[model samples]
Target: MNFNPVEILGLIAAVFTTSAFLPQVYKTWRSRSAKNLSLTMYLVFFTGVMMWMVYGFLIDSLAVILANIVTGFLTLILIYFKIRYKD
Candidate 1:
């Protein structure tokens, strides 16, 4: 688990970006409303994230893989909420 400076920077960036969705997920879950969320956008974003994950695996990048895995999970939750809380 030896990370170079660049990888460390990447992990930092990944932490920020991946955690960014927490508030939205919490809000959606607590409020039980996703009428304002765009399903199409999330679907597209999820697809992109999946691609990034694949790229990460191919490149053997830990930061990208970890970040996308968490992001993908959060995105899935948002998608589920969007469908379940559809108004």
Candidate 2:
């Protein structure tokens, strides 16, 4: 599969955006504290990401699809943590 420069850029952007949640996930997991996290916000964000993933699939965009896949998983984990570690 050949990728254009634009696609390459999208991949790079995707990496940054998707990895941005790592620190929060790690902190929440390690601290076992999700009291500060907003369930509403994460729920909305997860919904949006799922929509974006669908859009990506519709458009046949690998970067968007991959990024959303990872982001969705991370968001789900955070949601689980929030529910499981409720204060």
Candidate 3:
């Protein structure tokens, strides 16, 4: 397989930044709690990720688009549970 350093680097960066919220999500789901999780921040982040996904589509970057898609869905799930189980 031919590997392009730049593409690999971009995917790595995307994975890191996009998965940054995973810990919080796991903690919330595991503990069944959403306290201290900022709804506003997640809402804003969701919007941002949605936009990023759109931009990625426009630019024809499947990696970026798919990463953002998954991130966005997870964020939405967290956000939904957060609201449903507010402290």
Candidate 4:
């Protein structure tokens, strides 16, 4: 696949945005504590991510599609943890 500079930048952006959630996922997985996490925020965020993924698909954007798919799952994981760990 021939990638232009813009695509490269998009991939880089995707990497940053997707990886940003890793720390929280790791922490939540290890500590099983999501006390400070906001369920509303995640719900909104996940919905937005899903919408982005759909938009990506419609536009045939690899970076947007791939990134949002990964990010969407990560957000879902957070949501799962939030609900599972909530007291």
Q: Give the TM-score of candidate 3.
A: 0.82
Off-target runs (Cα >4 Å) in candidate 4 are none
**Residues 1-87 of candidate 3: C-alpha lDDT, one tens digit per residue:** 223786577678778876886887788988888988889999999999999999988877766777798889889989988988878
Residue-by-residue lDDT tens digits, candidate 2, 30-87 = 9999999999999999999999999988888898999999999999999999999988
> What are the TM-scores, per candidate, against the unseen true structure?
0.95, 0.94, 0.82, 0.92
Residue pairs with colliding backbones in model 1 are none
Model 2, residue pairs in steric clash: none
TM-score order of candidates, top first: 1, 2, 4, 3
Local distance difference test scores for all models: 0.95, 0.94, 0.83, 0.92
How many Å off is the CA of 41 in candidate 3? Answer: 0.8
Local accuracy of candidate 4 as per-residue lDDT tens digits, 47-84:
99999999988887889998999999999999999999
Candidate topping lDDT: 1
Candidate 3's C-alpha runs over 4 A off are 1-3
Best by TM-score: 1
lDDT of 2: 0.94
